[model samples]
Target: MEISRKNRRLIHTIVFLVLPLTAFILFVGFPLYWIFITAFKPESEISSRNVSYWPREFTFANFGEAWKNAGFSIYFKNSLVMTLIGIVLILVVSIMTGYVLARYKFKGKSIVYLILLCTQFIPGAMLLTPMFIMFSRFHLLNNVVALALINTTFQIPFNSILMSGFISGIDYGIEEAAQIDGCSRVGAIVRVILPLLKPGMVTVAAYGFIACWNEFLFAFMFTTKQASYTLSVGLKSLIGEYAMNYGQLAAGAVMAVIPVTILFINMQKHLIAGIGAGAVKG
Candidate 1:
């Protein structure tokens, strides 16, 4: 009788979870599965009326062709360059700005922070026209640097806010002690404060990296040169009017997702912890 009750409870739990699980598979999982299947299949299989979840044959040729033909080589390099520049800009600026906001108190500080936070409420799409005009004036319209700059600018608010919380959570006692020991204020921060903020740094760096990597709107609008194009733009052009080669497009997308997947796999632990650190510390 006890065993029967336990089995029934287990069944109830499974039934309750299964609906959402099935929904996820039908929606998110099925599409991703199709992308994977299509990436490996030949063009003939894709055009056939009968579509199966599994591929009849597999080939790496599609990936090789996509890699070479899609101009992703140029896009890949541009993306890397943009990602690095954007990350550096975000980290340096956000760290300094966050430290100031968290450590110092002065007149108008609250108002300043409020203003900064309010900027986040503005729709990014609304600013697109203004940004385009500004970049055009500066002759930055077709450059990867323009994309990196725009992405970093947009990302700064949230990074600074997160860092403020992280900085506040840290006790100032350690920095004070170091300063009392004959270290300068700058030295104390460098030696004592920044080291303890690794988790927050890691989190923000990951955010900056991912934002720059996959950003499409600004990248598409800003860069027109094939040499300057980011991966997202390059991938879209793969599906031209004359040919809707789903296999090659899927293969290109798979290639695009690989770097981000590897990055998350490596840093997911710290990313999760760092998210809570900011909220709890401040």
Candidate 2:
């Protein structure tokens, strides 16, 4: 009787937990596996009516084609430059805004918070027309710097609030102690608070990097020239009106995934900690 009951419980656990987890893993993992294989499969294997689980012949032609012929090299460079610029702008502004909100009391603070919260609800599409006109008037269309600025504009409010929460979690006494020890306000922040805020900084940077890197609609709409196109826009270019290059598309996707994946892997620990701390204090 005892052995039967233990067996039943074990069966229940497997049914309720193990089965669902395995299914979910397959559901997500299979597509990634398919794409990885498809990227290496030759052009003939890709367009065939017959589907194979594995590539019969693997080749590097897709990556070469995408990089050189498809102009992804230019797109990749543009994305790198724009993302780096946007991340720097985001970090600087969000940190300062967060520090103020967390450490100082000021008039209109509630109103500012309310405004920031409201901006999150505003859809990106709604601002597209106005931004286009504004950028056109300034002759900033097709410019990477302008793209970075727009990305920074959209990213700031949420990041500021997130940074504020992180700052709130830190004890004010630390900054005070630094000030008492002959450091100026900026000096204390530079020398003391920033080191302690590494986790929050990593969290913000990861979010900012993803946002800037994956931005598509803005990059597509604002930049008409191929030279200014980011990776997301470049990926869309692989689809023709009458034909699409599946292999190149898959190769481009793999390239796009690599950087963000590496970043997340390296910063996973700090990101988890920062999010948890911010959530509790926020």
Candidate 3:
């Protein structure tokens, strides 16, 4: 009877969960798997009607060719530099702003909060024209600094919200206790409150990193100089106006996806805990 009950529960669980699991496998898992396979396939096999579930013909040369021929090395370096710089700036600015919002009672605090929330309603595309003109006038186009600055601006409001929620969850008495122990206000934040904010910080950092990493429209619009091209822009070039090289395109796509995947995998536990904590506290 116990075994039958356990089997019945299992069947009900599968009935509810299996459809979503199957959809995820088909849409998310299979695409990643196909990219991995395609990254190693030859040019002919990639374009051919005969699709091998696994590569009947495999070549490491696709990656080598992509690395050398697609200008990915330079693109990868530019992407890394821009993403890192943007994330650092966003984190520093948002953390301080979030802390202030969470802890301080000031005039117009409600107005400030409302303004921050309202900014989220604006589409990123709406800022493009004004930003482009501003950057162009300043001759900042085609620079990684331009990309970093633009991305940071958009990231700050959202990140500040996430951080503020997390900061609010921590008791103000903690900072008060630290102050009583000879910590200055800044010192209390840096030495005590900041330490407690780590999980939320990690969560925001991952968000900022992925946002900058996969960002294309701004990168494409802002960067025209060959040296400034990020992986997304470089990947676009793999598809000519007329002809697309499927193999190299797939290889570049895989390259772009791999780093982010590995990063998430390594930080999976921290990310989950951080998100969960932030959500609960918020």
Candidate 4:
């Protein structure tokens, strides 16, 4: 009877834990595996009727062609500039907004919070035409600054709310103590509360960075010039009028993914830790 009980327990463990893990590994790993294999596959193998799971002719030639002919170097620099600028602006603005919302009690605060929540539901597609028109009126079309501003506007509300939660997690007394030591409100935040919010800040910054880096719709709409094209836009350009360059497309994807993947893995620990500490008092 005890042996039978152990058998049932083992079955439960496999069903609850092992099966899901195995499934996750396959789902996530398969795409990366596919891209990696396809990136190395020669054009003949890719376009052939018989598609092999592995590449027949693995080549470094694809990477060279992607960097040069695909204009990925230009795309890489543009993406880096836009992402960095947008993320910096987002964090700076979100942190301040979050601090005010979390630490202070004021009139209309709940209304402001509700409005922010509402913005989340507004589809990006809906905003595209209006935003394009607005930017065009200002003659900001095809500008990196315009793209960065648009990305930051779309990103800020959520990151601000997130930052508020991080701020709320810390005790108010710490800031008060800093105040007692002759620090101004700004100084207290910079010296005291900001340090404690590092984990949350990292999470927020990562979210903003990733969003801006991978954003295609706004990037595509805002910039018509190839010089201003981001990685996503550049990658999209790889799709031809007649025949696509799948190998170069895959190589560009792999190249585009490398920096963001490295950043995410490095900061994922902080991200998880920050998330575990919720913003709402409840």
Which has the greatest TM-score? 2
Per-residue alpha-carbon lDDT of model 4 for 83-177, expressed as tens digits? 99998999999999999999989999998888888887789999999988998999998788788988999888888888888898899999999
Q: TM-score of every model?
A: 0.90, 0.93, 0.88, 0.90
Q: Which ten residues in a row have the lowest lDDT in candidate 3?
A: 273-282
Candidate 3, residue 11: Cα displacement in angstroms equals 6.0
Q: Write the per-residue lDDT of candidate 1 for residues 116-228, one digit (tens) a residue.
A: 77777788788898999999899998787778888888888878978777788899999999999999988988899899988778889998999899998888888878878
Which runs of model 1 end up more than 4 angstroms from their true locations? 1-4, 272-282
- In Å, residue 115's CA in model 4 sits off its true spot by 1.0
Worst 10 residues of 1 by lDDT: 273-282
1 against 3, candidate with superior TM-score: 1
List, residue by residue over 47-147, the lDDT tens digit for candidate 2: 99999789999899999999999888999999999999999999999999999988889999998888877787788999999999999999999999999
Q: Note the Cα lDDT for every prediction shown.
A: 0.84, 0.89, 0.86, 0.87
Kindly indicate the candidate among 1 and 4 with the higher lDDT. 4
Candidate 3 residues 114-140, lDDT tens each? 887777778888888898999999999
* lDDT of residue 113 for candidate 4: 86
For all candidates, the clash counts are 1, 0, 0, 1
User: Regarding TM-score, does 2 or 3 come out ahead?
Assistant: 2
